[model samples]
Target chain A: MTASRFSPRRLAATFSLGLALASGAAFAANEQYFPLQSYRVGPYAAGGTGFFGGFIDYMQLINARDGGVNGVKLTWSECETEYVVEKGVECYERLKKGLNGAPAAATNPLSVGIAYATLERSTADKIPLITINHGRTDSTDGSVFPYVFPLQLNPYSEVSAIVNYIGQKAGGLDKLKGKKIVTLYHGSPYGKETIPILDILAKKYGFSVTHIEVPHPGTEQQSQWLNIRRIKPEWVILRGWGVMNPVALKTAAKTGFPADRVIGNIWSNSEDDAAPAGDAAKGFISITTHPAGTDFPVLKDIDKQVVKAGKGNLQDPKRFGNVYYNLGVVNGILNVEAVRIAQAKFGKRPLSGEEVRWGFEHLNIDNKRLQELGAVGLVQNLKLSCADHEGGGAVRFQQWDGARWKVISDWVQADRALLRPIIEKSAAAYAKEKGITPRNCAKEG
Target chain B: MDFFLEVLIGGLLAGVMYSMVAIGFVLIFKASGVFNFAQGSMVLFAALTFVSLLERGFAFWSAFAATLASMLVLAWAIERGVLRHLVNRPPITLFMATLGVSFIIEGLAQLLWGAQVHGLELGIKDEPLEFGGVLLSSFDLFAAGTAAALVLALSLLFSRTRIGLSLRAVADDPLAALSVGIRLQRIWGVVWAVAGFVSLVAGLLWGARLGVQFSLSLVVLKALPVLIIGGFSSIGGAIVGGLIVGASEKLAEVYVGPLIGDGLENWFPYVLALLFLLVRPAGLFGERAIERV
Candidate 1:
């Protein structure tokens, strides 16, 4: 009787309208998704902003310049992690859940600590974790970490590249015999990762390695340098971040350590990091995945299309072709290409998380394509597969010339013959702990 | 031996800084019988103001003068606005009020200067002065000299001046002093103003050394051990306590920190202070008092 009293026609009309809206929202949600777990505040905010700016600018460029990838309309949302692991995890959960109309297709946790934490979860979610150049070295095992893709060189590869450069500079690998290499590292997971690789290399090359761990966000290290002075290490590999890099350089300069002998990791090498040390860091060689400077065509395009068009996220465009920004651009291009690759398989349309994962797993970028994309100066040929997430372990040595970084070495790939077994063993052990079987690459095909 | 000597000197220099801030705490506590937890925040605020003003194109001396003037105003406002209302409140209430004041000052400092560490160069050379294989930084020397002069001056003021006599009278017995025509409120205000001045000096020195940052409040924790070690009521004790804590921590970091891991320098001072507190509850120079029920 109550239902009869209520206008049945009006109720039906209202219900239909609601259903239509909900379905429309659901359809929009299935379209595309991009989740950005960013660190816009904290100790590393300077580096974070540059990279995040590049990422956002590229995404905007995609929307404005290309009218979305294959007309599916690219959608993205950012959650700030503040460079804290717990907050990063929270951002991952929040961003992955998505809004009413958009769901997260891929996650780019722009922090090493965050990447380490999310590596396991990304595997479970099957959501591709595009760790550009910083994350767990073991995640390079694509068979174990099916969804975790460290696009370029990890710490292991970078250190290998640095040591390789050092070897070359010293005339040959035989010259490293009986040499003392000190690793003055920022005492964190990020800094600690380099030690094992260095240690392994030390054992193999018959070199003595002394690891001096500097505390997080290091501001004081006089005693560490003093010890280094007493020991008189032949070379110092600085695996520091934030203020630690410059402080180390300054201390090394004071202690009369040859600036040329101090080699910094990718994270430790930046114009901001180098500028503070000034002449002290003049000859400080740093291993880089991408060359630093704004002379690249890709950066010019970013300046013209993104910045000039009022879509630029960078406050200062001079920081456009810096280390982290270039890394971000490379990451952006990789992400776009993955989507394009996925589209090739599925259809000429917006790809879902699963489709994107497939795209990332099978991405193949040759030298010509890289050059065509204006990413030639930044990165070389990268090909990802189901069994190898890192694609290759290639990096170049760049020396800081007081004001700018100049490339001193050509592209060098890590000896895969040495790394493959290590990666496999680590990945297998990890998979066993998690009760996961390595995904069969042949079966996937 | 040389390394130990260097560390000891560094520690002592650092300790002087702790003492300067602790002295402010001691002065406020001695006068009001309430612990001023806001002393470190005051130091940070003063440093921030000085640096900010300097950064905004104000000449160094002008900025310094403006900072002192601002601190004087802050001290006056705190005495009139907060302390005046809480004069009759319990010691715990006053303590809590100071903590609240600390948070407010922090928020205001952030609002005024933003949450970025500003390099505060006081134009004092920081290069080490070498002497017979012993090296000591110029800033450390300046700090030690300034702290010694300040302490000596404060001791003279308390011993010889009429206002100091009134302050001591107020500290000894507020009710009796008021009956004897000593304005307790005015004396308290002057003491607070002096404490504020001490905070400003400490802030400028400390800020110049470490770069002005929001974590500047942690420096207050460095003073707490000093307060506990030196007897909260004794100005001389504050300086002594600071020296002990600072020297011990620096030495511990060099000799003991590496044994545990890095970053022990930050926590060693607190641990040492805790140990001292366990042994000396009333602190080294605290006056023995008998309560009349």
Candidate 2:
């Protein structure tokens, strides 16, 4: 036994194992891990792949150019959710623990259903769960949703921004008086989330609005379009998703409604939604937090550094600067900036999930920072706090011209003053229901 | 009255599309008692293959031929790799197997062609065509014509061919047909290939309408009520059942839906299907099952 222990092979193997363990520890100490609950195959896979691909590509760019943010390397692993809520929860449970003893930076599920399902679990785990442009409207109050970030815009803000844009087009809010509008929405909680907000806005602006629902998956919408023809509203707000968007545009055409009069919401604004409708989708406009196209300096850098080097995550190069991909890149920028902000407060090593949550709450990316990041006009200026999770209540409008989207408006800010009170009321109600004592952001400041 | 007629006509035209999908199910069910749950995946697979090819610069006819070949190959693989192994399995077992196959095919379709939405152009503009004060979609009219031609061809194949006779015999009783020297495997293979062809047609039309994406497979949900109302075993039943489901659901969504909160088209067909099941489980044109219990 003694002679065996002293063997040359055994000694070499032990030495190698020790060296590997030491390096692994060193690697873990200097890394910020992001647990990506990504979907690459499902009904929503097109959106998922583009978004996650953009996100991963942005992170890859960071690693390639900056060698990590402040000497802390960015690392991530994806757990495919297929856009299913249960699968998302499973992914959350599987990946809440960071890799190789590194603390997880955050979780970006990208699905509203998954985000809602894991809200409590994410809070309990003390990890930040980022829902870029969609989530519960009440979750905007970071006091109650400390671990959840609705990022740039929440549901209420999205509708408000659209209404504001509509107002801007109508000459003024007062001019919208007596004007009739119809909202064709998907039949889900997400689609219904803005109903009250729209109603409030309608009443406030002296406009009459009609709401029509399209069932889930929304394939056949002839009846709804026929009804829209009957109503003859001046504008049709298409609050749709997946196959519903193109179907709405096509049906609107069949029903003799001008495509230019249809205003798609954030989810309905993608090239995937417009291109399918062909000529019917011409001149169709939608709201966006970020514009599509690789003309932005950030996108050009990504194409040059990440994609050209074969380190890009997009399976199809055609989707490199599409709407969803741009949203993902914007999302990646926000997440990384949050980590950088947190590192400034706490030391520059791999921080825990709670520390990262604080970073997200304090995320402030103004026009100066956007310019510095070479993401001007690509991402809206955002400033988050414990009282407000959705910092950027603004959107730009774009129109589809048969082949691609052309930005048609500058950043149109939502009436956040009008929306803030409503957001607080809902958040307060939620806090009372959950028996949660709201955080004192004043003291945190 | 004109508005009502418009809704009714639009719905009936839409029903033709549902009938197109149901025809694929009817083909498989009539020949082999298996429900072939992978039919939707086949549609997605075919459309994805065709559009991906088109994007890669394949001509229209060339892409169509290649997609048809792929579907036929898929039919052969399903018969050999799946249905062949479970020749005499229970209907439930076959259904479960096909359900598993559906997931595999969906994954494989996305894996083979990257998960990206591609707009399919069939060259038929979806512009409105007015007829007697009622506006109808020209594209929908083209779809209706295609459906009519497909149904007629399928009807002829089943009624006026020796292979059709063998298929009918096998459908009636596999053991008896096998004893009489009707190659059951060959009939199953032929029926599946024909179903595959139907899926290609359905896929092209649907892909053109909805864009070729993962959601293309979700049209299966729309066919469920049609199948239930028409009975899974009859192609003609599928057409009649589709018309009933389509027109009634649209009319309901427009007229009755407002009274009971709208968006009833999705589930109203299921209600009608349930009523049909209660009254006539064999469907309008389906043969009555004479099982000796």
Model 2, span A1-445: residue lDDT tens: 9999989999999999999998788776789999999999888988999999999999998989999889899999999999999999999999989987778999999999999999998888899989988998889988888888898888888888888888889999888999999999999999999999999999999999999999998999999999989998989999999999998998898889999999999999999999988889999999999889998999999999999998889888888899999999999999999999999999888889899888988888888999999999998888899988889988999999999999999999888999888888988998999898999888887
Clashes of 2: 0
Candidate 2 residues lying further than 4 Å off, grouped into runs, are: A1-28
lDDT of 1: 0.79
Per-residue lDDT of model 2, residues B1-293, tens digit only: 99999999999999999999999999999888888889999999999999999989999999999999999999999899998999778999999999999999999998999887888889999999999999999999999999999999988988899998898898788889999999988998999899999999999999989888888888888898899888889998899988988899999999998899988889999888888889998788777879899
Off by over 4 Å in 1: A1-31, A253-260, A271-285, A290-292, A309-311, A314-327, A348-350, A396-416, B14-59, B62-129, B138-238, B257-263, B285-293
Show pairs that collide, candidate 1: none
lDDT by residue (tens digit), candidate 1, A1-445: 7876578887898899999998777656545678888875554566777787777777777777777778766777778886888999998888776555554668888788788788778767778888887787888887788888888877788888777777887888889999998998877778888777788999998889988877655655656776676678888999888767776876676545788988888787777567656456789888788787766777777777778887787666657777777777778888888888898899865556777889988888898888877777687788888888888688888888867889988897776667778878988999899898887887885
TM for chain B in all models? 0.94, 0.98
List TM-scores for all candidates, in order.
0.82, 0.96
